[model samples]
Target: MAHVGVVGPSSADQRELDDAESLGQGLAQRGHVVVCGGLGGVMAAVSRGAAQSGGVVVGLLPGTDRSAANPHVTVTIPTGLGELRNALLVRSCDVVVSVGGSWGTLSEVALAVRTGVPVVALRGWPLPGDPAMHAVDSVGEALRTVDALVRTDD
Candidate 1:
């Protein structure tokens, strides 16, 4: 029922990829939309999962060509802003779920926190200054947290 951003490294290990895929599937099966960077790594995995589950996927790409987007993306938006497109991805989400670590993913998390959009992280930035951004254990917990956070009027 919500558009969730899935952010993480463009190159990650197999476990992270699996986790991200599961998260995407879970979100999709629950009728939520998946949004991501639209390239490779976690982005591709999540997109694939969502697509396989018959869920919609929106990829905010960083280049001028939609060809760079993952094949599973239902909708691709090429921003031509490169990394700066990270801001757009965060801003467009109802909530963000970060799968693994990277400067890019951290930036997305920081933007989401600053902009009042809640983040359900898996294995990303370790923000000691922001304990509130710490990750929960599983994909289900992440989605549950996101649902709980977004449902609040605050």
Candidate 2:
């Protein structure tokens, strides 16, 4: 199983949050680890989902204080780089699942593409020139796409 990074806004619509949470639970149910920015919104929701599913959750925190991570985070990595930690989060993951569009989430998608990492966008950024980043409509579709990409890369 690979580490999957879930990226999105700290504050988001209820639909996106629900999708992120479902994605986390699905990923965990399959034995994959969930990774996030470690604060709130999508991060907290995904972490909570993974934790609830009895899966491991890692939070790549932007601040120096580990306590800033959401309660669902099983492992907290305090980077102290704030948003710049986005690059590290993307690089550390084998695949990235973006839940909603935010500047931070967009940056993670861009970095994942640049680094040749697979990114399954779930209603995320509409960046030009990367057809691979098209947003999947459901959690099942996203997981299928991620599974295909990981198996292909392997």
**What's model 2's lDDT at 146?**
79
CA lDDT of each prediction against the hidden true structure: 0.87, 0.87
Q: After superposition, how far is residue 72 of candidate 2 from its true place, in Å?
A: 0.3
Highest lDDT among the candidates is held by which one? Answer: 2
lDDT at 142 for candidate 2? Answer: 91
Candidate number achieving the greatest TM-score relative to the actual structure: 2
User: Which residue segments of model 1 deviate by more than 4 Å?
Assistant: 129-134
lDDT of 2 by residue, 71-121 (tens): 999999999998889998998888999987877788889888888887899
Error of 1 at 112 (Å): 0.9
Mind giving the per-residue lDDT tens digits that candidate 1 earns over 1-154? Answer: 7888999998999998998898889889988889999999999999999999999999999999999998999999998998899999988888889997888888899988898777888866677555346488777788788778667623
Q: Which residue pairs come into collision in candidate 2?
A: none
Count backbone overlaps in model 1.
Answer: 0
TM-score of each: 0.93, 0.95
Clashing pairs in 1: none
